[model samples]
Target: MNSRYVGYLFCGLAMIGVGSTVVVSKAIAAGLPPFSATALRFAIAFPVFIVVMRVRRVRWPRLSRRDAWLAIAQAGAGSVGYTVFLISGMKLASAADAGVIAGTLPAVSAAVAMLALGERPAPALIGAIALATTGVLACTIHFDQLSSSRGAGAFTGNALVFAAVVCEALFILLNRKLSRPVDALPLSALMSGIGLAVAIVPACFERPWTLPFDANALLGVVYYALVPTVAGFVLWYAGAARVSGAEAGLMTALVPVSAVALAALVLHEPVTSSQLAGVACVLAAVWLATFGRRLRAPSTAG
Candidate 1:
């Protein structure tokens, strides 16, 4: 079995883990204030993270002064900023919209990889990103209906989600830089700690921090803490190590598809013509991004 395929598998599962959070977060958002909801989930996850690291004998890295600040920034952007923007976006936008917006992460990550990491995208990747970008625009700029609340405020919500995506992209690049030698579990624990530092103060204002007893909400917190926060980070970087950042970016395109599917089934959000068109374009883009190179050359192992 190819390690690249293994990487894709880990990334795909991580994608699903991250994607499905939209519906869960939406449900949780109804019961808890956005900041509280974000804070509560990590509060549970971070302590468990410490336990897991200790149990697994994953020691923290002794980083240089520069790397220490880098880790803090990474945690701030990826964990704290990403969560704040995303949860707030979900509160304002439909889960379906948030799902569709998430598709942009791959394109954003690719661009970030190219500019920051000095990795140039091949022509096929460029084309695929164009298609995905068009799809995202289609989803966001709905010509048919602009009178409704969601439509009127869509920009604010979607923009925030897009900002979250950028933060996540930065996290991906930083993780690629940092985790070449550092283990994912310890790195995640450190990142989560910094995230808690950022979340705690804001969360304090929203406190009493009472989580809901509703099965869905409880499940949201538990799954978020375990699946996405703990396991998703582990699996994502584990896979990322075996593949290119471009490939990893391409892989996260699955986020919106899964998120939209779950949003429809769980949130009962309407599926509009724009959403249909956007999804079609996004799927096509993903197909191209993932396999377009193979049309020109023999597929190589990552």
Candidate 2:
């Protein structure tokens, strides 16, 4: 199998993992507060990541003083900042809207890569960005129903979710610059360890520990920890190692589509016509961004 194909597959799976997280977190939020839920999710996953690193015989690298702090900062922004903003956004906005807004992470990442890292995007990618932006607007900007509370809240939440996406994008861009002298597993473990500490302090104020005791809540926490936090990150980083950051970012579009679909089915959330249109646009953009080059390539002279 081609490495790029494998990278796509891994990234697609990671998106699904990410998509499921919104629903799972929402369910848990019913019983626990948002920050508490976020904290526990990482706390459980942190140990599991550490165990995996040990099993893989991955060793941590000796970082320069500066690199060590940078790694910590990356973890803080990606894991800590992302969770805080996402959970808060979900509280303020519908899960569907949050999911859709989170889809912008690829565009955010592409912009950061261009401005900070001197990476350039192809024309196809630019078209995809336009398509995605249109889709997001179509999905979110319902002029006919502007006065409704749900509609207004969804728009606000989408904005915060976009903010969270930017933080996540910045994390990926920063991590790309870090010299990876350590094994991926151990490095991930260290980052997650730092993230756990960062999350704990704020989580205490939110008091997620007192969430209503129930089977659904337990399952939600377990699923979040195992699937999204641990497995998703591992697959994502593995795919990132083999693919371009733009390619990886494009795959994240699946997260919103999957989340909306799953929410309609499991949570009984309504799937409106406008939302469907938005999904189509975003999908089209993702396809162009990811594969347009191959379709436009000139035939070999041979």
Candidate 3:
């Protein structure tokens, strides 16, 4: 198999893990304080990363001061900032709204890549972005649900969710900026440690010790740590290392598609016709973005 195809697979799976977080995080958000939950999630995953590294005999690579700071910033934006904002946002916004707004990630990531990484996208990729954005809006947005009745809180929640999207976009672009690229495992472990450090302080104010524990919430947090936080980070970095920033950005279109599907499965939300249609569109977009180049290339004469 082509390495690029493998990169796409890893990225797609990573987005699925990311999408699962929406349902999981929303479930736990009310029961767990956002900052504390973020802290605990990273804390749980950090040790697991260490164990895996030790088992694999993967030693931590030496980093320059710049790379060290870059790692910290990545943790701040993607690991800590994204989780805090997302959990906090879900407190006010409906999961559907979050999923709808999260649909912006592909565009946000592409724009950020263009601006920050100087990535000039191919025309096919641009079309894929359009298709993806439309698909997410189709899947998640209900025109009937949009009204003045939604209130200021909804707006604030949407804003916070968008903030998470931007942080994630930055996180994607920053990976491309690493002067000396670290392997996926070591980088993920480094990120988990930094995230724990950054989030634990804010978590203190939440008075985590005093909060009553909910078993379901605890389980959600544990799942988040192991799957989304640990596995998602590793898969995303591995894929991002193999692909262009723009391509990685485009892969984020899968996030909301995964979110909507998981919501139906886990929350038992009914799947709507519009949602099914949206899924089809997103799949087409993925196909176009990943294979359009080959399709456009002229075939050799027999």
Candidate 4:
């Protein structure tokens, strides 16, 4: 029983949770305002995380002043901020479009890595960025004969999702800066708490009871809270313990793929040719950007 193999299994399971988030989040938002929905999701998940930490007897990380601010800022951008944009965008766009748009995240993160971390990218990486951009444009533009309000809303929603990706990318970059890093589980719990705090005031302001409360809404919110945040984080960090960063990056492909399939099946969203093309290009870009170094062949002996 190799630990690394177990890590892979954990990570694979986590990827499924990440993939289904778009459809589930969209469903949750349908019955609640974006702020209220995000607040509810994090609020519900945060206490569960506290319980898990306590039950596991996890040693909490003592944070320095800088680390405290880091947790707050990171939680804002990555957790609360990203969720807000995502739910709002999903309300406007089809789940399938949101799913496809998510594939571009790796490309965004790679660009951030180069700029913020001073990593010099190879030619393939540049090509990957270009291809990703082109793909994004293709999916976003509605050049088809049919022009309607739905098309316009989809465009706006997709753009907002892209913005959410940038916030997430920035959070990733900032997370790299912690000289005294905490263990993933405790850190995640802390971050979730921070997210709850950030969302509370806004959630209070948002008109409650705008959406008719029902059993389905309750189910949707519960699923969003437990499945994606709790289970996904646990599995992802566990797998990350065994997997190389490269392999972890490669695994991200599953999110978009699973998202699209789930959106189509669960939400009954149609997948268009342009979106398929965009997904392909974005996947290719991610592969090239992530693995471009290893893919270079060694020089032959003279």
Query: What lDDT score belongs to each candidate, Candidate 1 first?
Result: 0.79, 0.77, 0.80, 0.81
**RMSD for each model, in Å, please?**
4.4, 3.6, 4.5, 2.3
Candidate 4 at 57: error in angstroms?
Answer: 2.1
Please provide, for model 3 over 1-302, each residue's C-alpha lDDT reduced to its tens digit, 9 standing for 90 to 100: 99999899998899888888888888778789998999999899999999989998999989888988888999999889999999988877656556656766655677678778788987877877788677656754556655655645666776788789889889878887889878879888888899999999989998978978788788989999999877887799889988887688668777777787777777776767776677666666765666666667677999
TM-score of each: 0.82, 0.84, 0.80, 0.91
Considering lDDT, which of the candidate structures 2 and 3 is the better prediction for this target?
A: 3
Residue-wise lDDT of candidate 4 within 47-133, one digit each (tens)?
999899999899779988898888889999988888889888888877777776777788888788999899888888888888788
TM-score of candidate 4 versus the correct structure, residues matched by position: 0.91
Best by lDDT: 4
Whose lDDT is higher: candidate 3's or candidate 4's? Answer: 4
- The sequence of per-residue lDDT tens digits that candidate 2 reaches over residues 1-302 is 99989999998899988988777766675666655666777789889987886787766678888778888888888877787677667665666766676666666677678788787788877787788788788778878666988777777777777777888988888777777555667766777788778878877887655655767866887898888878988899888878997688678778888888887888888887777777777778767766777777787988
* lDDT against true structure, model 4: 0.81
Tens-place lDDT per residue, model 1, 120-229, is 79887788788878887888876655777667687677778888889998988886775345667887788878887777787878864465456666677778888888
Model 3: CA > 4 A from native: 1-15, 96-107, 139-144, 151-158, 231-255, 298-302
- What's model 1's lDDT at 171? 88
Candidate 3 local distance difference test against the native = 0.80
Count clashes in each candidate, considering only residues at least 3 apart in sequence or on different chains. Answer: 0, 0, 0, 0
